[model samples]
Target: MYLRKMLFILLTFVSAVSLAACSDDENTTAATPTAKANVKVVHASQDAPGVDLLVDNTVAGTNLTFPNNTGYLQVNAGTRNVKVNVSGTSTTVIQANLNLMENKFYSVFAVNQASAIEPLVLEDNLTNPASGKAHVRFIHLSPNAPTVNITLTDGTIVFGNVAFKGSVDFTPLDAGTYNLQVRDAATNSTVVLEHS
Candidate 1:
């Protein structure tokens, strides 16, 4: 009788230990890390009011006016629902389904005018520039602006023949301040915009 009781208790303890080990394995599998991506938002709509950026109905940016931008935010890799709404309101002015890949970076630009607002999604290349250099790119966000050449004040064209809503790849430049001008591409002499 004593031997049988000892044997029963040993079997029960062994069964409980086995179950606990199996549970730990299941928990480890469920805790696998999720793939992720990085994204940034740029408010470039020329005529739209200050806006908010939403990802899957969650506000990612708020009260972003023209030419403002939000820093990169990490998100799960997959198709994400992106939306832009007027500041302080739930009225969605633009929405898009964006496919984001793991370990990549993206930029979402809210562009055009209030009457024709849209999203311009661009993949960002984050390759490091060479020493003493920086990366530069040109994006034409003016809704009604003409095809233009981006140039230095000295008339050296940095980006040529960029039309409205056009964009250019990143170029390496020596780290320094630059005086830039947007000139008509046809004539390349009429400065429509200037920046330093």
Candidate 2:
């Protein structure tokens, strides 16, 4: 009788050990890593080696490049301030924050040098497509200029005042060489015409 009792206890102990080992194997797990983010820029004219980069008013990097006028830059998942300069002139400055996702691609392009902070002379229609109804747009780029008024080659009045970073659209009244006059809204005295 004692022998049989001893045998039963040993069997129970073996079964408990086997169950414990199986439970541990099921609980084991693996981990996955986070992804990366990317950003790109495209323009009619590219930024040269002297361009500067900033993040939240902090200089992050500079002197960007791309052979095809497409510059590529990488940043962590967060917001940044993008700054560009040409030679000695800071042609333009822009502030933007991008929410980047892990392992994702992004593009931030500043095709026009005119930022909202500056005054500029805007001649909206450059291509001058003969389609009378073709649309053209102009925007001011001077920091202290306003309003856009100009006399066409024919001495016709168009656009009065445009604030800095403001825009004007022109639907060519007639298909002909129209001299564009654009001035800031504040100082109507300063106006420029794009002569074709």
Candidate 3:
């Protein structure tokens, strides 16, 4: 009888332990889900002052200066629109689709997409702007130059430089509308040869 009682006690203890373990598992909570990825974008171009940088119809910044007519964009892993304009020429309009990703960087360059050719070289008064303004194609031909700088009438200055030539060509500005002061940091000279 005593042996039977001891066996019953052992079985009871095992069952209780199992029940407790099961209860603990049922009471425990699960972990939380992970968050989505973050994104960012940047834009710069030759027509820094004249070009408008837009992402998804949102105006990021405008009238800014850049070299290589290039820029950057950060967005979700999806499609985006990058529009370019030189103002008046028949080629004032240029556009591209940007593929963005979470926590990633995007590089964009304004070049012709039709035949793998370079972007149009914007020259004010040469073809006349659609806005009826003369423009400037601030070009930095010296790729070996350390930096290319631009100064506006308002005392605002912008700087950039490319290590290679044939990289980018085009800056659109209103002729006789704005004052532009450009210089090459390497040669300590101006890049925009002719200013109107």
Winning model by TM-score: 1
> Can you write out model 3's per-residue Cα lDDT over 65-180, one digit (the tens) per residue?
33332333334456666565443222334566655444444334343222332232221122324453332333333322444555564435533443322222333444343445
User: Any runs in candidate 2 off by more than 4 Å, and if so which?
Assistant: 1-94, 98-130, 153-155, 170-173, 183-190
Candidate 3: stretches off by over 4 Å: 1-49, 68-73, 86-92, 111-196
Candidate 1 Cα RMSD after full superposition onto the native fold (Å): 21.9
TM-scores of all candidate predictions against the true structure? 0.79, 0.37, 0.31
Among all windows of 10 consecutive residues in model 2, the one with the lowest summed lDDT is 5-14
Model 3: what TM-score? Answer: 0.31
Q: lDDT tens digits, residues 66-168, model 1?
A: 7777888998899999889999999999999999999898988887778998888888777777777777777777766668787888888888898777888
Q: lDDT (0-100) at residue 146 of candidate 1? A: 66
lDDT of 1: 0.75
Whole-structure CA lDDT of model 2: 0.41
Q: How close is candidate 1 to the true structure, as a TM-score?
A: 0.79
Q: What is the C-alpha lDDT of each candidate?
A: 0.75, 0.41, 0.37
In model 2, what lDDT does residue 152 have? 57
